[model samples]
Target: MRMEQLASRLTLKRAGNLVCSVCWRRYKRSSIVHQWSRYWITTRAQSPSSRPSSSLKGPAALGTQPTTPPITKKQFPSQLELRAVQRLDVLLEDCQEFLQKEVVPTEDTILDALKTCRKLSEYFRSVKDQPALSTIKPGGEAGNLLFLDADPADTQTASSRTLTPIAVGRMASSIAEEAMDKIAETIKRIAVDKNVYITSKVLQEVVDILCLLNRPESLAYIFILYSSKPVPKPNQRPLKYTKANPDRITAAIPLKVAERALDAAIKVQNLPLCLDIIEHTVSTKAYKRAKTLRGAFLPAVAVAMTPGAAYIVASRLAEMQEAMSTSMMTVIGTAGIITYIGTTSTLGFIAVATANDQMQRVTWQAGIHLRERLVREDERAFTDKVACAWGFADPRRRGEEEGPDWEALKELCGIRGMVLDNVELMEGME
Candidate 1:
């Protein structure tokens, strides 16, 4: 009877019929145990040590651990930084356009624009390592300020578009005096700081602008910064041209600076500055070498006839004449007279002779006879000075020591006897 009851209960439960509570509980317990067994088996199968090496090689595996994603580096500016740069670009563009229209901005406005430009320049230098703010053009009616890059083709056309102005002209107008003062200050600072952006060419352009504005005092300050100790600050006082500071523009320029400034002054026809540089060159013994003396002579004489520059001209000419005489003698003693004359004539000696003739004419016209008398009076002494100036060893002192080999010296002088005769024959034919 018990077996018959049990079998009947089981059949009812499996058929989904009503069952006793104890039998239902027993059925749920068995289902739970089966699930637990399956889970334990899965856990053992997925153990990392039990996994195959090939399976672990790929990114996904049965027992693969969760990995932290790689950290990436940021290479470029952020959106906010880029937006700020764009704003700066727009500000510079507007400032440039305003100055290009020949309308000088007020002192405050100019300063603000310059500050923006400098900030942008600093940013560019830090980020890009280039002179970002240097592309300013001095454009407008007078065109007296620094110029910006322009299309070469557009320059010939009346329909050419106006260029962007990067910086205001120092002397754009009389009111720009304060702006000019600030520029001078900035330049001095740049020089002291040795800022690479303000290149020698850029400094030259600044000097050119100062010269154009007729600011000799400020120009003098620029030249002084090149070679003097304790660079003097730019004076805020208005520059005044006066007799006391006649050559103040080039007053403290060093030899190298003076040489370059001479060319610039001559180009602009700044007679006083030219003469001042010449005097500096002479007084500094800067022309002690034959190469430098030769290089400076033509340019010095080119301006010698200018009113107050006559003395400078005459002095340079005398020195040059003396040097030439000494060089000629040295060459003749070493290479024979024919080779010396031929060599000298070819290498600008003819030009120097012509310049001498021109100098005589200029002196005659200007009523300057002192230089002529001085040259004539000290001819022998001048020759000796030239010889000494060139550091030539005295043959007399050498006594019995062999002098310079004439044949060797002649070869070095570069003309053969045959070539000389051919040239003479050609001249005769002509």
Candidate 2:
């Protein structure tokens, strides 16, 4: 009985070892085949020298019977490998369809489609002859993918003949006006709900589109909408006013956008739009607001020096003064009436006494500043012309009386006897 049990145990152990040895050999063979397959694919893909010959010949052409047949696309070694290739192909087709059919192909949708293509390409990278993986290119057929293509001739004609700068501006304004309703609704929602916030990127994109369209007026409107603080209600407690933090708001216009709008407004001579931008920038406490305002305002006021413009400037300045007065009254109202009278009377006296004097000084200073800059620019231009003429003129005429006389040139230019700084002339005008 003991001898029979030993023989049975030895037989079981031997059987287990044989099974393990066979499994190990199978695993080793699979690993070697995988390595060779990967190396062959890589070499063929990278170098034309290693590629299989296109010509077909009999086995006797090499003077020996064939040992192995060449692999083909339809004859993948394993079912799993074949399935993976098929899956990658299907995924690529799906992505192509999605890109073609997307109604509003935004940046995100395009990126998602590219990501799908990339994954599929990586999976089938070992398939050296696969055209689908190799042919795929980023932004291939972009116009078709985004559905943004129009007839080139029609687009050119429409843009050149029908879409003038003014028409473009009007179209941009209309688009911005349509967006304003949505933006206002968002703002209201954010005001009501503390957790709600606007996406900065979306707002920036809107601003960018408007600027690209050259719609300064619309951009100024956006700036004004965000910069103006809400008026406090009489029945409700006042909300604490913190310094404008862009991160906290549902929608905050950037100072650079305001600057760009201001520049565009100046370029198109849109005075009202320029003024609106200045007002918003000042209200928002944008950095360097005063400097930007002065730069924009001086050029505009200097260019449009008509009586109507003077009246507009005067009216705007008066409005500013009135706003200041109202703010003072509000502060005084917070205290008792007795203190209000003393403070109000004192402030009123000071304001009345100095307002006219300050206005005159400001007007004089602005005129002088503009005149100085103009004179310097004119001098530089004159110097440059003189240098160029001297450098390029005939050397033989260096000492001859060929050039125009300075006095004669001045006379012809209508400044022969003009005195720039005559005290008697200034006093007579006054």
For every candidate in turn, the CA RMSD to the true structure comes to 32.2, 27.7
Model 1 off-target regions past 4 Å? 1-175, 192-203, 228-278, 281-283, 287-354, 357-430
Candidate 1 residues 165-261, lDDT tens each? 2111111121133333444444344433321122234445545443433343334445434333232222323322222232332333333444455
Which candidate tops TM-score?
A: 1
- For lDDT, the strongest prediction is 2
Candidate 2: tens digits of C-alpha lDDT, residues 53-137: 4312222333444443233221222222333334434544554464344132344543443344333333233222222222222
Which residue segments of model 2 deviate by more than 4 Å?
1-142, 148-200, 228-255, 282-430
Backbone collision count in every prediction?
A: 4, 0
Residue pairs whose backbone atoms clash in candidate 2: none
TM-score of 1: 0.26
Instruction: Spell out the clash pairs found in candidate 1.
Output: 137-147, 137-148, 138-146, 138-147
Quote the lDDT for 394 in model 2: 55
